[model samples]
Target: MLFSSSSTSLSSEVSQVLSENIPSRSTTLTGDSTQFQINEDLGTEDLTNGLPKKLIQLKKLKNGGTTIKKAKTDLEYCYDSLRLYENPYVATSRDKKSGYSIELCLDNKYKTLMFCDLQLNTDFPVYYDSSLENVAENIERENVTPLQIRGKIRIHIDRDDQALLITSQSISLKCFTKEYACFVDSGTGENTSSSKIIKELNNTEFFESSSYPKQQLKVTHHSSSDQKILLARGTYDYPFTFTLQANTFPATFSSFFGKTHFRIESSTSIMRIPSKPKGFLKFSKNENITDKIILTEEIKVKRVLPSTNMLKFEMFQLRSYNAASDVVVSVIGNSKLIEIGIPFQMILSIVKKDPSVELHDASLAVAQRMAIPSIDLKTMDILPEPYIKKSEYLLRTVESQSFDSDKTVYGFCFDDVIIPNYADGLPSWFKTFYFEASSFYPNYAALKVTHLLLFRINYSKNEVIEGLEVRKTYRVTVNFPVFVGDSDISTSSLLPKYEKFENISDLQDEPPLYSTVTVEGDN
Candidate 1:
């Protein structure tokens, strides 16, 4: 009986296995037990041949699932991580001629990294005409050209990756002009008529060219680094030499309606991953791609005046006092303006009606008015330093008198008076304040240094009683405006004229002859 039961179970299991193995045209169960139908158009070859058909189907599934793994990894490069020590760097014509320096840095960690190739691409505007006004019209007519200057630097990484190998780099500047013709049409076709009246209109045209001729200036490398320098993983500094030329203008300018712009761009060809070979058995080329990491910053070229040319001088009167007798005080020097750490000269002249009146003493005082204290807690309640509380003189001087009997003029001259460098303290209600630029006050128009001249007169008692003596004492004050700038002053002379005669007739060999003739007529 046990054998009989076992036989029945075995028979049922065999029947189920056969049903699963056989390919069904209508429906089939997947490994997840999801049922789906097969397309009748695919044909029923597997349905007729059961076991072999199942083997074929499994082989096809295995082949479809197979994938070939990539052999070479993709190299990653990031331009956004690049940093420049100076951006929008300015290089004047003098600077460019003398050469300039720039610093750059890169932050990256990669094992398969190679060398970096740095390139500087410069573009300078070249106009056909010297006039800037016609630049728009010339541009619209496609008459403007661009002059290019290129420079390069290569950096190779060491095997240990500790430092980079650099080559000497240089910047070369060249200026040139281009000529082109522009045509403009002025006639309007709105007045076309059937009975055509052909009228010739006047046409006007002019030729234009650069004011200065073509010129070239070269600046050598001034970098301390050798031809092959080993730079570390940090910032790399490069210096270049520049030479100034006669025709050189400011680095960037707009003139005659046209503009000349100068720009420097840095680019690198490195940090790119090599591509794998075509076939499975093939290897990667390991060759560096031309792909480059271009920096976003573009350095600007400009021009700056030398320190010697920065100083300027001008003459302006301070004040005049009219009393019992006219007393005029004027300051004479290289300039009325004063700066810190610079010495200047000043002269005080006093004239009086009575030559007999002797000069006792004379002094010059510099002072400013104190600002009103605000209702703030810190300032209004507490008293501050002596310098803050009172409007004291920043500088004071007593001058000796020199009487000129011939001119009846008493004069005092002070030389090399230096302005002390003082900290510009904070503003409060009780302290005098000066702004970096200019400051305005409500009641008092503006804040400035006040110069006071105190003079004492020694006169006879009888002379004092006379109206000629304006007063026992005289005070003449003036507002002295000060500025901070260069001390050196620059002057220019007109170009000398040369004698030239295009024709002998224009030279006038001798003065024209004049003769007098009288005509008598009978009345």
Candidate 2:
């Protein structure tokens, strides 16, 4: 009776269980019938508990995290989830200088999940990470946990001439996505292949949160009530956990962006103590006053790809034409989809190569291909709008080992080992956020994102086709119009419905309210 009879397959299971307990003509629903039959098809046990099998299956999934479950997820707003200031996060920055870092240690099936903004995509009722807690129906909890900011700091004391104390902490998250532009500059042009953030997408801050004073700083149950802490000479470790307002704020369309970034900006108010050292130490003449220091660390967030018009993955196969010999290339991966933050692995095979060619280096890159279809007014002809294309690479090596002549051995690149034929596991992380973050973005916009997997075989050929070929360098190019995003696993299928939808102009022209906030300044 909990779930009224719906078209779901559970109706059939309930029917079979019901027939065994009551007569065919009996309208009353009860187990007190004078007559009952137990057969092999209906099971040997008598009816004791009236719970259906569907509820039992859900009970098991609740204990373990299940992403993209069948049930409709209910959003439950939560705040100040944890106060973790004791555990030290894994220290990074191989350099000797003291610094800080953080990692998203998740308990879900996948280490990294996607996050969408509420304002960007207004179509569907998208759920937040908080829903994974206990908001979803039946299952009282999420398939995984969220947010553990683990970090450490070190300092050296030469007789404690001056003191440093931390009085407070805070964090912020930012989002910046754009479509097309020209003749513009905003500081990101150089690194992004001359691409600049459109004036419309410029955001001061998407989300800001600061630690509350009532909550314990170092420990939750300490007898003393002081929240401030003093940094003694040597090295000490610490961690902080924060809660994000995942829902209620503006969510995003399923599109993805490299510029969209989430990071922890700890706002700390520091005070210097005026003290004379025991020996030859020096101190500043200025009196001690509380100043501020801002520390930043990169964190990853992605929207949950529900079981709807889910993302797709496929085998990448192609052939490059050469009059001398045809170059056949096929790349395979363990999983169906290519997700970000995971090492990408592909089995690449090539055949019928020109004998004089020497394979030197190869790389896989995420190319966000863009073009606009339009009509020429003067010519009265159709032509694709010209959008200059470019690609970027950070040096990654492909380790090779002896194998059958037909196939090659490739492993991930670690140190500066020579890379001949083999490729390291997939370098599928964001490629500076260029991969297919969503279903090629914007289901309703002409400005859309298309992905291309460019596998270039860098080699040197002895024989030259042209008379003036001085360099003798050649490239066997293989291109795959590949797909790399989550696919649906639902019983039937559902379209991603947008609860709210905004066009380019409306979103850009909208006014944003401002409030007062404390910021740091240089002396």
Candidate 3:
């Protein structure tokens, strides 16, 4: 038998059934003995009228309560028949201009004949009216407004236990201009017609502004059936989508102060089992789900004190004493204590002793190195085995500025150097090794784990070869200690212990601040 009804009548019937069956308050079941009443109006109708009966079962329990059971002959059902098996059932984005897509799957037992009317609704409460009446009117109009749209499509589905891809619909937000005005009530005044405009925020002007996007879906199932018989199907599209809108704040204060919510609703037509025509039956169910679409990304900011003494390092005479040119390198910055996601600057200066030396093709690099330990098996002893250092470049420069011609000073400045958020690895630790200070001094053992900053410089020198000027290569390497602790370490904790001074000049009168230093021969 063919079953059909108007959209308004079907909506009313569904609403009635939902209101009657759904409990208003929570109830607990104790004993099994119980009995409940099922809606008799939902029973199957006579086939002569071309209408099938909707069978509903109510089983009695020992706890004196009743539970609703599925009808033995009910084949037609609403969206409750479908299930969601994918994550992000609702896609989200931060950019206001971005769009999103959704995927849905059908139950294995039912096959869809066709989808009637597919509607897409975008609601932005902050920018447009989101009242129930307005929403209903918008859906009925089926116009493409800045916040909502209703799509028309005709698609057939026969797959089971597979996804029904709906890739055509994409949701996005747009900017528009709105006018705001302030009015005063003219109750007992001279010109008491209604109200008078006192002031206006925008002076009736159009100002473009953007808002968040909240998308919803509505689909109509034409025909769906299982192995036994076909379920209820008709021409009019059913309301398959749930209420979805952008979040709002307290009306007492702010009107738009919350994240936008995107909703995805999947539903199936009400099903009726083929049974002896004795009573009427009606059933409608749907699933409503929502997710938040972030409008902006969050950033964390932190502040830290600056440390001077322990963070500075300088290396004098980086090359051999008898080299053609001498280079002195110095780095000034807070290295012992560093915070992730904070910007800081470091100063690097290089001074050449001889003014006559001309350097070309100069480059400098600073890298963080990791030292791994190893043991010697032949001697059955632990030896100072520093593995091949793995380096991560922190700063690099191919250009430098010269300060003076008399004593050439080249400086490279690293500005706004930021430690990445994911650099919180293992902390520095000390390793023990036996070393002799000199031939005359006695041997001693020392334990230390040092964070070394490798400074490298490469340049070319002008030389005469075979009665012609030639460019010869020259290189220099310098190592400086950089005490790197955890990213959360504070600068004040690494500073030397001394009394606070009232002013910069008074700091000289106070005891000098110093940190312990361990000196060992080069390995």
Candidate 4:
């Protein structure tokens, strides 16, 4: 849910917090079964009693098969939601436009957004404690100014539908989220598993993890100046705008158990007004037709946090024994951003050597930790701590490598290693490796995933502290936090640079102390 700038000084401010809740759906369709017969498309099926089925077919036909043809829109999107900072295509399936209907367009297109970068300066702050101001304060719902999104909609009524009139239009940014602890079966079609929660929670029994609506902006309405004009319309164009109060809208993800999402909805109501009999009471009452065109567009939101650890030239070092002397390990890349399909460098050098110390086989690996933050059952807000699940993958290993404290000045750089993108399937693996665009996105309130680069040093040393000489074997580890993001969006001007080094004593900076970094862990 949060990210830090590299150093302690930079990360002192607040961090990003996930928005509270997102609804399962933006709009629901409901109606009474009034048997009627009609034909528009789909080979003329019965017009009554099959509303849901009818809508599905209409959506495919109207939106051209559930996707937007790129030729029609300026926005570009990624096919998968795994990578960060790419526009995501949500539902573009529009209802069939016919008879009396309204079309709502955002920035001129009805495309749903999956990820959007929120630039935070003093303007947008991300908040962690929410007590005092911090770097995250810009995006904090309680602190920052509301963000405005504008769009235009056109209402059209057929010439024959003379009584249909545009009454009022409503626009709102709907931010809501929900979680369900079920009966352990995803297909159960049930939300909360009350029996399970009660059994698991035995401490005086307070259960059910669901949050209330965290942040919301008032619904906005735009109405035509007067209603005296003929209820029917040739065409009406009205531009509407919505302001988003919650800046940290998490990327939308839904499963049987939980959901985090955001959407914008616009509703236009139209009703048929009965006209009094004109030339002398010819006829009486007519069935008044009332309809509302509600349009919902889901959007993805992301917060970009910068860190020096990801820079190529921003070198970081970890000494085996002491901050002042002894063996050292160095990585050529920044600590923050470790990317897949890209390689980084790691080096080992004995800055100072003695016959008492010996270096053996060494290996580098990556550890992945997915932290599903704990939620308060009562408030539904995310707690500070998380329930972390971990898995490890081997990056590269060295069976034998020689390093002399006096001879190896530049240190021994290992073979480049990468985060795998091709090992796509485990349950199903093909003879050939297939590529998947799915890699863990950096941080999310609902599900936060993080990685670490681990350098495991295997060595033996002889010590004579006591009266007798003793030989000892030891495994020392050096780890670095890995933040995932696209390389194009990196804040570092250039990659880490290096200068010629002839001797160990010629190094400029003092030895590095221990580094304490964790995903969403701020100091």
> What's the count of clashing pairs in each model shown?
16, 31, 43, 23
| lDDT (tens digit, per residue) of candidate 1 on 146-237 | 12223232232222222222222333232222211111222347774322121111121211122111222333232213333323323333
Which scores greater on TM-score, model 2 or model 4? 4
Better candidate by TM-score, 3 or 4: 4
Worst 10 residues of 4 by lDDT: 430-439
Q: Estimate each model's TM-score.
A: 0.26, 0.31, 0.27, 0.48
Writing each residue's lDDT as its tens digit, candidate 2 over 1-523 gives 1112231232121121112121111011111222133112222222222322221121122112111122221211111111113111221221112122222222232222233221212242111111111112211112223323333332232333333344433322322233222222223345664332322222222211211111111211111123444443334333333333232111222222222323333333443333434221321332334443333333444433333333323233344654556344555543333433333455556553555454566666545443222323334232334322344333343322222234333333223221122245433322221222211122212222344566666555565456664446666666554333332122112332322447665553533311111112211
Model 4 C-alpha RMSD to native:
19.7
lDDT tens digits, residue span 1-523, model 4: 0112221221122121122221212211111111121122112223122222111111322243332221111211112122112322222323334344456667622333312233323332221111111223233322333345666555555544233334445554544444332122213337754221311211111111111122233233434333312234355555655433333344444433234555554555554333334611321222334344445565544333333222333455655553323445555443444555456666665443445566676777776654343445554443455455556777777664455534533356664656655454211110110011111211323333445667776767776666888887767677766544433234223323344689988886853211211222122
> Which stretches in model 3 have alpha-carbon errors above 4 Å?
1-322, 326-330, 334-340, 352-366, 378-380, 386-388, 400-407, 423-450, 465-468, 491-523
Residues 101-215 of candidate 3: C-alpha lDDT, one tens digit per residue: 1123222211111111112233421112111122223322121111112221112222221112111121111111111222334366677764433221222111111111111
Error of 1 at 498 (Å): 30
Model 4, 468: alpha-carbon shift in Å? 16
In candidate 2, position 116 carries an lDDT of: 29
Largest TM-score belongs to which candidate?
4
What do the candidate models score in CA lDDT, each in turn? 0.28, 0.30, 0.28, 0.40
What is the Cα root-mean-square deviation between model 3 and the actual structure?
31.3
Which window of 10 residues has the lowest lDDT sum in candidate 3? 248-257
TM-score of 2: 0.31
Please say which candidate is ahead in lDDT: 3 or 4. Answer: 4
